[model samples]
Target: MAKGHRSQIARLRNENKDTRPSAKVSYARVSVTKACFVLDAIRGKDVTTALGILAYNNRYASSVIYKLLKSAVANAENNNGLKADDLYVAECFANKGPTMKRIHPRAQGRAYRIEKRTSHITVVLDEKK
Candidate 1:
């Protein structure tokens, strides 16, 4: 805690904040590995190309990521005052979320645990420099 006024400290924090536009989906039903497959395809591609890839991809995660990517693009355009054409997928990844455990009954009275995994997926976009 350095000596500074409250407003000044807030200003300093704002200066260090990441200005890039991004979107995240929490507790997405898809697993990290599956989401990463879609994320990997569009990680560095331009927004238009990324959308195109997402549009035609057959993976379930692609549909979720596609909507998330669209939201990120809208954020870049509206919130960041950036043009859609100049934006690209700068960074994107998925993180593990809470795992929901379910019980599967086996033969007799044996119980087996089944994990319904969830993930938090994020897509960060930046303007092409």
Candidate 2:
């Protein structure tokens, strides 16, 4: 049991030691599925191309993701001393967040529950090999 704990600790430490610059947008007013559509398009894509795609994409989530991608690139350049041109999106994903419960009035004095979903999106940028 002690040996198992040691390995688990090592794994946790390694996971927390990522050097790539990343940015996260939490509690974004978008569903995970909608955010994933935009994130999928930019995963493994270069920063410039990803920016262009986000700029012209019609999805509502794209606008939120565009700001996030820019922030990640800025983090890489300013904090990590990396060139924006040399960076690519190494990882991008969206996770489900809390839902805002709302009530919609209906006929006969009834009310319908509405759930406005939210998501937490993250983008990690790394230098090209």
> For every model shown, what is its TM-score relative to the native structure?
0.91, 0.89
Give candidate 2 misplaced runs (Cα > 4 Å): 1-16
List model 2 lDDT by residue over 1-129, tens digit each. 235688798997888898999999999999999999999999999999999999999999999999999999999988999999999999999999999999999999999999999999999999999
Q: Which stretches of candidate 1 lie over 4 Å from their true place?
A: 1-9
What does candidate 1's lDDT look like per residue over 34-115, in tens digits? 9999999999999999999999999999999999999998888889899999999999999999999999999989999999
User: What lDDT is obtained when candidate 1 is compared to the true structure?
Assistant: 0.95
TM-score of decoy 1? 0.91
**Local lDDT at 10 for model 2:** 91
- Residues forming the 10-long window of minimal summed lDDT in candidate 1: 1-10
